[model samples]
Target: MGRSGSCLCEAITYQIPESSLMEAVCHCKNCQKQAGSAFSTLAGIKKSDFSLTGKPKLFVDKATDSGASVERYFCENCGSPIYSALPSQPDVIYLKTGTLDDTSDFNPSIHVWAATKQNWVEIDSNMPQLQKQS
Candidate 1:
Protein backbone atom coordinates (compact mmCIF):
# COMPACT_ATOMS: atom_id res chain seq x y z
CA MET A 1 0.00 0.00 0.00
CA GLY A 2 1.02 3.59 -0.58
CA ARG A 3 0.76 6.64 1.61
CA SER A 4 -0.86 9.89 0.56
CA GLY A 5 -0.43 13.55 1.46
CA SER A 6 -1.22 17.02 0.22
CA CYS A 7 -0.33 20.65 0.64
CA LEU A 8 -2.36 22.84 2.98
CA CYS A 9 -4.64 23.88 0.12
CA GLU A 10 -4.74 20.44 -1.46
CA ALA A 11 -3.35 21.96 -4.65
CA ILE A 12 -0.32 19.75 -4.53
CA THR A 13 -0.70 16.08 -3.60
CA TYR A 14 1.74 13.21 -3.41
CA GLN A 15 1.94 9.47 -2.79
CA ILE A 16 4.75 7.21 -1.70
CA PRO A 17 5.13 3.49 -1.43
CA GLU A 18 4.73 1.39 1.73
CA SER A 19 7.68 2.89 3.55
CA SER A 20 10.35 5.53 3.19
CA LEU A 21 14.08 5.13 2.87
CA MET A 22 14.65 6.89 6.17
CA GLU A 23 13.17 9.45 8.56
CA ALA A 24 14.90 12.20 10.46
CA VAL A 25 14.60 15.58 12.11
CA CYS A 26 16.61 18.46 10.65
CA HIS A 27 17.67 21.22 12.99
CA CYS A 28 19.72 23.16 10.51
CA LYS A 29 19.12 26.89 10.51
CA ASN A 30 18.14 26.87 6.83
CA CYS A 31 15.57 24.14 7.47
CA GLN A 32 14.15 26.04 10.39
CA LYS A 33 13.85 29.18 8.30
CA GLN A 34 12.13 27.36 5.47
CA ALA A 35 9.77 25.52 7.78
CA GLY A 36 9.11 28.56 9.92
CA SER A 37 9.67 26.43 12.99
CA ALA A 38 12.30 24.93 15.25
CA PHE A 39 12.93 21.94 12.97
CA SER A 40 11.71 20.08 9.96
CA THR A 41 10.46 16.51 10.02
CA LEU A 42 11.68 14.74 6.91
CA ALA A 43 11.17 11.39 5.28
CA GLY A 44 13.58 10.28 2.60
CA ILE A 45 11.84 8.83 -0.39
CA LYS A 46 13.07 7.55 -3.72
CA LYS A 47 12.05 9.63 -6.71
CA SER A 48 10.94 6.54 -8.60
CA ASP A 49 8.65 5.44 -5.78
CA PHE A 50 6.91 8.75 -5.39
CA SER A 51 4.03 10.12 -7.41
CA LEU A 52 2.65 13.61 -7.42
CA THR A 53 -0.08 15.85 -8.82
CA GLY A 54 -0.11 19.60 -9.35
CA LYS A 55 2.82 21.89 -9.87
CA PRO A 56 4.95 23.24 -7.07
CA LYS A 57 7.22 26.22 -7.22
CA LEU A 58 10.89 25.59 -6.65
CA PHE A 59 13.31 27.79 -4.84
CA VAL A 60 16.97 26.94 -5.17
CA ASP A 61 18.54 27.61 -1.82
CA LYS A 62 22.27 28.19 -2.13
CA ALA A 63 23.04 29.40 1.33
CA THR A 64 23.22 26.16 3.24
CA ASP A 65 25.40 25.05 6.12
CA SER A 66 26.52 22.09 4.03
CA GLY A 67 27.60 24.40 1.20
CA ALA A 68 25.30 22.56 -1.16
CA SER A 69 22.23 23.79 -2.94
CA VAL A 70 18.81 22.55 -1.83
CA GLU A 71 15.79 22.64 -4.11
CA ARG A 72 12.77 23.53 -2.01
CA TYR A 73 9.38 22.81 -3.51
CA PHE A 74 6.15 24.33 -2.32
CA CYS A 75 2.59 24.92 -3.31
CA GLU A 76 2.17 28.24 -5.06
CA ASN A 77 -1.50 28.36 -4.19
CA CYS A 78 -1.24 28.14 -0.41
CA GLY A 79 2.51 28.47 0.04
CA SER A 80 2.73 25.13 1.85
CA PRO A 81 6.04 23.39 1.63
CA ILE A 82 6.04 20.11 -0.23
CA TYR A 83 9.53 18.63 -0.29
CA SER A 84 13.21 19.33 -0.76
CA ALA A 85 15.80 17.84 -3.06
CA LEU A 86 19.57 17.95 -2.99
CA PRO A 87 21.62 17.99 -6.13
CA SER A 88 24.06 15.38 -4.85
CA GLN A 89 21.22 12.99 -4.10
CA PRO A 90 19.33 13.11 -7.35
CA ASP A 91 17.38 9.95 -6.71
CA VAL A 92 16.12 10.97 -3.31
CA ILE A 93 13.75 13.66 -2.11
CA TYR A 94 13.19 14.65 1.51
CA LEU A 95 9.48 14.87 1.94
CA LYS A 96 8.21 17.26 4.57
CA THR A 97 6.43 14.80 6.85
CA GLY A 98 4.09 17.46 8.18
CA THR A 99 2.30 17.35 4.84
CA LEU A 100 1.46 13.69 5.22
CA ASP A 101 -2.12 12.74 5.80
CA ASP A 102 -1.07 10.41 8.60
CA THR A 103 1.98 11.44 10.54
CA SER A 104 1.34 9.35 13.63
CA ASP A 105 4.03 6.87 12.59
CA PHE A 106 6.74 9.43 11.90
CA ASN A 107 9.42 8.24 14.26
CA PRO A 108 12.57 10.13 13.49
CA SER A 109 15.53 7.80 13.77
CA ILE A 110 18.09 10.55 13.84
CA HIS A 111 18.53 14.29 14.30
CA VAL A 112 20.73 16.25 11.93
CA TRP A 113 22.40 19.62 12.49
CA ALA A 114 22.06 19.31 16.25
CA ALA A 115 24.74 21.94 16.68
CA THR A 116 22.26 24.57 15.56
CA LYS A 117 19.24 23.19 17.34
CA GLN A 118 17.03 25.63 19.16
CA ASN A 119 18.06 26.37 22.75
CA TRP A 120 14.70 25.25 24.09
CA VAL A 121 14.50 21.97 22.17
CA GLU A 122 15.47 18.81 24.03
CA ILE A 123 16.28 15.61 22.20
CA ASP A 124 16.13 12.07 23.48
CA SER A 125 19.46 10.82 24.79
CA ASN A 126 19.09 7.53 22.97
CA MET A 127 18.21 8.89 19.52
CA PRO A 128 21.19 9.30 17.25
CA GLN A 129 22.17 12.94 16.72
CA LEU A 130 24.67 14.50 14.34
CA GLN A 131 26.31 17.79 15.08
CA LYS A 132 26.10 18.40 11.37
CA GLN A 133 24.77 16.64 8.36
CA SER A 134 26.46 13.23 8.03
Candidate 2:
Protein backbone atom coordinates (compact mmCIF):
# COMPACT_ATOMS: atom_id res chain seq x y z
CA MET A 1 0.00 0.00 0.00
CA GLY A 2 1.06 3.61 -0.53
CA ARG A 3 1.85 6.15 2.16
CA SER A 4 -0.58 9.03 2.54
CA GLY A 5 -0.41 12.59 3.94
CA SER A 6 -2.52 15.70 4.15
CA CYS A 7 -2.41 19.29 5.25
CA LEU A 8 -3.17 20.32 8.83
CA CYS A 9 -6.79 20.98 7.96
CA GLU A 10 -7.02 17.99 5.65
CA ALA A 11 -7.90 20.30 2.80
CA ILE A 12 -5.05 18.91 0.72
CA THR A 13 -4.05 15.28 0.49
CA TYR A 14 -1.36 13.27 -1.33
CA GLN A 15 0.16 9.81 -1.62
CA ILE A 16 3.60 8.36 -2.20
CA PRO A 17 4.32 4.97 -3.72
CA GLU A 18 5.61 2.31 -1.35
CA SER A 19 9.00 2.23 -3.02
CA SER A 20 9.74 5.95 -2.71
CA LEU A 21 13.10 7.13 -1.46
CA MET A 22 13.88 7.78 2.20
CA GLU A 23 13.07 10.95 4.07
CA ALA A 24 15.38 13.95 4.63
CA VAL A 25 15.56 16.94 6.94
CA CYS A 26 16.63 20.22 5.36
CA HIS A 27 18.18 23.02 7.40
CA CYS A 28 18.25 25.50 4.55
CA LYS A 29 17.14 29.02 5.35
CA ASN A 30 14.26 28.79 2.88
CA CYS A 31 13.00 25.63 4.53
CA GLN A 32 13.33 27.13 8.00
CA LYS A 33 11.47 30.28 7.06
CA GLN A 34 8.77 28.40 5.18
CA ALA A 35 8.16 25.92 7.99
CA GLY A 36 8.65 28.48 10.76
CA SER A 37 10.81 25.93 12.45
CA ALA A 38 14.42 24.82 12.82
CA PHE A 39 14.24 22.55 9.82
CA SER A 40 11.86 21.00 7.32
CA THR A 41 11.35 17.28 7.01
CA LEU A 42 10.67 15.96 3.50
CA ALA A 43 9.99 12.65 1.87
CA GLY A 44 11.31 12.33 -1.67
CA ILE A 45 8.92 10.63 -4.06
CA LYS A 46 8.60 10.48 -7.79
CA LYS A 47 6.07 12.85 -9.32
CA SER A 48 4.11 9.82 -10.52
CA ASP A 49 3.57 8.75 -6.90
CA PHE A 50 1.81 11.92 -5.90
CA SER A 51 -1.71 13.23 -6.50
CA LEU A 52 -3.43 16.35 -5.23
CA THR A 53 -6.97 16.30 -3.93
CA GLY A 54 -7.48 20.01 -3.68
CA LYS A 55 -6.20 23.23 -5.15
CA PRO A 56 -3.10 24.59 -3.43
CA LYS A 57 -1.32 27.91 -3.75
CA LEU A 58 2.12 27.66 -5.28
CA PHE A 59 5.08 29.81 -4.20
CA VAL A 60 8.12 29.63 -6.41
CA ASP A 61 11.43 30.32 -4.72
CA LYS A 62 14.91 30.25 -6.20
CA ALA A 63 17.54 28.06 -4.57
CA THR A 64 20.66 29.95 -3.56
CA ASP A 65 23.13 27.31 -4.70
CA SER A 66 21.71 25.91 -7.94
CA GLY A 67 19.77 29.10 -8.76
CA ALA A 68 16.98 26.71 -9.79
CA SER A 69 13.43 27.46 -8.86
CA VAL A 70 11.42 25.34 -6.46
CA GLU A 71 7.66 25.42 -6.43
CA ARG A 72 6.15 25.07 -2.97
CA TYR A 73 2.51 24.12 -2.73
CA PHE A 74 0.39 24.78 0.33
CA CYS A 75 -3.18 25.14 1.39
CA GLU A 76 -4.20 28.77 1.30
CA ASN A 77 -6.84 28.27 3.98
CA CYS A 78 -4.54 26.85 6.64
CA GLY A 79 -1.13 27.89 5.35
CA SER A 80 0.18 24.36 5.53
CA PRO A 81 2.92 23.44 3.10
CA ILE A 82 2.06 20.17 1.39
CA TYR A 83 4.88 19.59 -1.05
CA SER A 84 7.64 21.12 -3.14
CA ALA A 85 8.95 20.48 -6.64
CA LEU A 86 12.19 21.60 -8.24
CA PRO A 87 11.95 22.88 -11.79
CA SER A 88 15.35 21.45 -12.62
CA GLN A 89 14.53 18.07 -11.06
CA PRO A 90 11.11 17.42 -12.52
CA ASP A 91 10.90 13.75 -11.64
CA VAL A 92 10.77 14.19 -7.85
CA ILE A 93 8.49 15.96 -5.41
CA TYR A 94 9.41 16.43 -1.77
CA LEU A 95 6.37 15.86 0.41
CA LYS A 96 6.30 17.70 3.71
CA THR A 97 6.54 14.94 6.28
CA GLY A 98 4.67 16.93 8.94
CA THR A 99 1.53 16.62 6.83
CA LEU A 100 1.59 12.85 7.00
CA ASP A 101 -1.01 11.16 9.18
CA ASP A 102 1.65 8.87 10.60
CA THR A 103 4.46 11.32 10.99
CA SER A 104 6.04 9.14 13.66
CA ASP A 105 6.75 6.56 11.01
CA PHE A 106 8.94 8.99 9.11
CA ASN A 107 12.64 8.78 9.87
CA PRO A 108 15.08 11.19 8.32
CA SER A 109 18.12 9.32 6.99
CA ILE A 110 20.05 12.49 6.24
CA HIS A 111 20.16 16.15 7.20
CA VAL A 112 21.16 18.62 4.51
CA TRP A 113 22.28 22.26 4.64
CA ALA A 114 23.37 21.78 8.21
CA ALA A 115 25.74 24.69 8.13
CA THR A 116 22.76 26.90 8.77
CA LYS A 117 21.24 24.71 11.45
CA GLN A 118 20.00 26.57 14.48
CA ASN A 119 22.23 26.42 17.51
CA TRP A 120 19.39 25.44 19.84
CA VAL A 121 18.38 22.46 17.72
CA GLU A 122 20.21 19.21 18.22
CA ILE A 123 20.02 16.54 15.57
CA ASP A 124 20.80 12.86 15.72
CA SER A 125 24.56 12.54 15.77
CA ASN A 126 24.54 9.28 13.86
CA MET A 127 22.75 10.68 10.83
CA PRO A 128 24.88 12.18 8.08
CA GLN A 129 24.94 15.98 7.75
CA LEU A 130 26.09 17.73 4.62
CA GLN A 131 26.63 21.44 3.99
CA LYS A 132 24.26 21.20 1.08
CA GLN A 133 21.90 18.71 -0.47
CA SER A 134 23.82 15.55 -1.33
Candidate 3:
Protein backbone atom coordinates (compact mmCIF):
# COMPACT_ATOMS: atom_id res chain seq x y z
CA MET A 1 0.00 0.00 0.00
CA GLY A 2 1.03 3.66 -0.41
CA ARG A 3 0.75 6.79 1.65
CA SER A 4 -2.61 8.58 1.56
CA GLY A 5 -3.94 12.08 2.18
CA SER A 6 -6.99 14.25 1.78
CA CYS A 7 -8.04 17.85 1.83
CA LEU A 8 -9.41 19.40 4.98
CA CYS A 9 -12.95 18.72 3.87
CA GLU A 10 -12.10 15.35 2.31
CA ALA A 11 -13.20 16.69 -1.03
CA ILE A 12 -9.94 15.63 -2.55
CA THR A 13 -7.86 12.54 -1.77
CA TYR A 14 -4.60 11.20 -3.07
CA GLN A 15 -2.17 8.30 -2.75
CA ILE A 16 1.55 8.27 -3.34
CA PRO A 17 3.72 5.20 -3.40
CA GLU A 18 5.90 4.68 -0.33
CA SER A 19 8.85 6.44 -1.88
CA SER A 20 9.44 10.07 -2.76
CA LEU A 21 12.32 11.85 -4.37
CA MET A 22 12.75 14.47 -1.70
CA GLU A 23 11.16 16.36 1.16
CA ALA A 24 11.74 20.07 1.72
CA VAL A 25 10.41 23.31 3.06
CA CYS A 26 9.51 26.17 0.77
CA HIS A 27 9.89 29.74 1.97
CA CYS A 28 8.88 31.37 -1.28
CA LYS A 29 6.49 34.25 -0.77
CA ASN A 30 3.90 32.66 -3.02
CA CYS A 31 4.08 29.35 -1.14
CA GLN A 32 3.84 31.12 2.20
CA LYS A 33 0.76 33.00 1.00
CA GLN A 34 -0.85 29.87 -0.36
CA ALA A 35 -0.17 27.89 2.82
CA GLY A 36 -1.15 30.82 5.03
CA SER A 37 1.95 30.09 7.06
CA ALA A 38 5.61 31.04 7.32
CA PHE A 39 6.52 28.19 5.01
CA SER A 40 5.17 25.17 3.17
CA THR A 41 6.30 21.59 3.80
CA LEU A 42 6.62 19.70 0.54
CA ALA A 43 7.30 16.18 -0.67
CA GLY A 44 8.44 15.68 -4.22
CA ILE A 45 6.63 12.65 -5.60
CA LYS A 46 6.74 11.28 -9.07
CA LYS A 47 3.55 11.79 -11.08
CA SER A 48 3.37 8.17 -12.14
CA ASP A 49 3.28 7.01 -8.52
CA PHE A 50 0.61 9.46 -7.50
CA SER A 51 -3.08 8.63 -7.63
CA LEU A 52 -5.89 11.01 -6.97
CA THR A 53 -9.63 11.02 -6.43
CA GLY A 54 -11.94 14.02 -6.75
CA LYS A 55 -11.62 17.14 -8.81
CA PRO A 56 -9.52 19.99 -7.47
CA LYS A 57 -9.69 23.54 -8.76
CA LEU A 58 -6.56 24.72 -10.51
CA PHE A 59 -5.20 28.24 -10.30
CA VAL A 60 -2.47 29.28 -12.67
CA ASP A 61 -0.29 31.63 -10.71
CA LYS A 62 1.69 33.85 -13.05
CA ALA A 63 3.08 36.39 -10.66
CA THR A 64 5.90 34.62 -8.86
CA ASP A 65 9.34 35.51 -7.57
CA SER A 66 10.75 32.69 -9.68
CA GLY A 67 9.18 34.26 -12.79
CA ALA A 68 7.63 30.89 -13.62
CA SER A 69 3.99 29.95 -13.79
CA VAL A 70 2.84 27.65 -10.99
CA GLU A 71 -0.23 25.50 -11.24
CA ARG A 72 -1.79 25.50 -7.82
CA TYR A 73 -4.38 22.85 -7.17
CA PHE A 74 -6.72 22.97 -4.21
CA CYS A 75 -9.98 21.66 -2.88
CA GLU A 76 -12.69 24.12 -3.75
CA ASN A 77 -14.99 22.99 -0.96
CA CYS A 78 -12.63 24.07 1.80
CA GLY A 79 -9.96 26.00 -0.08
CA SER A 80 -7.27 23.61 1.12
CA PRO A 81 -4.27 23.44 -1.10
CA ILE A 82 -3.58 20.00 -2.57
CA TYR A 83 -0.46 20.21 -4.65
CA SER A 84 1.62 22.45 -6.90
CA ALA A 85 3.03 21.74 -10.32
CA LEU A 86 5.71 23.46 -12.35
CA PRO A 87 5.87 23.33 -16.12
CA SER A 88 9.60 22.84 -16.01
CA GLN A 89 9.18 19.59 -14.10
CA PRO A 90 6.09 17.97 -15.53
CA ASP A 91 6.84 14.55 -14.03
CA VAL A 92 6.91 15.68 -10.43
CA ILE A 93 4.37 17.31 -8.15
CA TYR A 94 5.06 19.09 -4.88
CA LEU A 95 2.64 17.71 -2.34
CA LYS A 96 1.44 19.80 0.56
CA THR A 97 2.50 17.69 3.55
CA GLY A 98 -0.12 19.18 5.86
CA THR A 99 -2.78 17.20 4.03
CA LEU A 100 -1.12 13.88 4.62
CA ASP A 101 -2.87 11.23 6.69
CA ASP A 102 0.24 10.96 8.86
CA THR A 103 3.00 13.54 8.96
CA SER A 104 5.11 12.21 11.81
CA ASP A 105 7.60 10.78 9.35
CA PHE A 106 7.99 13.96 7.37
CA ASN A 107 11.44 15.45 7.67
CA PRO A 108 12.60 18.21 5.39
CA SER A 109 16.14 17.75 4.14
CA ILE A 110 16.40 21.22 2.69
CA HIS A 111 14.85 24.66 2.80
CA VAL A 112 14.34 26.61 -0.38
CA TRP A 113 13.70 30.30 -1.03
CA ALA A 114 15.50 31.12 2.18
CA ALA A 115 16.07 34.62 0.82
CA THR A 116 12.48 35.49 1.58
CA LYS A 117 12.00 33.26 4.62
CA GLN A 118 10.39 34.92 7.59
CA ASN A 119 13.04 35.99 10.07
CA TRP A 120 11.02 34.78 13.02
CA VAL A 121 11.20 31.20 11.79
CA GLU A 122 14.69 30.01 12.54
CA ILE A 123 15.93 27.11 10.43
CA ASP A 124 18.15 24.40 11.84
CA SER A 125 21.77 24.89 10.88
CA ASN A 126 22.13 21.19 10.15
CA MET A 127 19.65 21.37 7.30
CA PRO A 128 20.79 22.62 3.91
CA GLN A 129 19.21 25.88 2.74
CA LEU A 130 19.03 27.48 -0.65
CA GLN A 131 18.46 31.14 -1.37
CA LYS A 132 16.27 30.18 -4.27
CA GLN A 133 14.85 27.18 -6.03
CA SER A 134 17.50 24.86 -7.43
lDDT for each residue of candidate 3 in 6-95, tens digit (9 for 90 to 100): 999998999997777999999999999998999999999999888999999999999998899999999999999999999999999999
Full-model lDDT for every candidate: 0.94, 0.85, 0.93
User: Which is the winner by TM-score between candidate 2 and candidate 3?
Assistant: 3
Candidate 1's error at 97, in angstroms? 0.3
Q: How close is candidate 2 to the true structure, as a TM-score?
A: 0.91
Cα-lDDT of candidate 2? 0.85
- For 1-134, candidate 1 gives per-residue lDDT tens digits of 88999999998999988688999999999999989999999999999998999999999999998899999999989988899999899999999999999998888999999999999999999999999984
Worst 10 residues of 1 by lDDT: 11-20
Estimate, for each residue in 1-134, the C-alpha lDDT of model 2 and write its tens digit: 87788888888887777655768899988988999998899889888778779999999887555466779998999999988888778888998889887776787889999989999988789889998763
Of 1 and 3, the candidate ahead on TM-score is 1
TM-score of each: 0.98, 0.91, 0.97
lDDT of 1 at 104: 87
lDDT winner, 1 or 3: 1
Best by TM-score: 1
Where does model 2 exceed 4 Å of error? 63-66
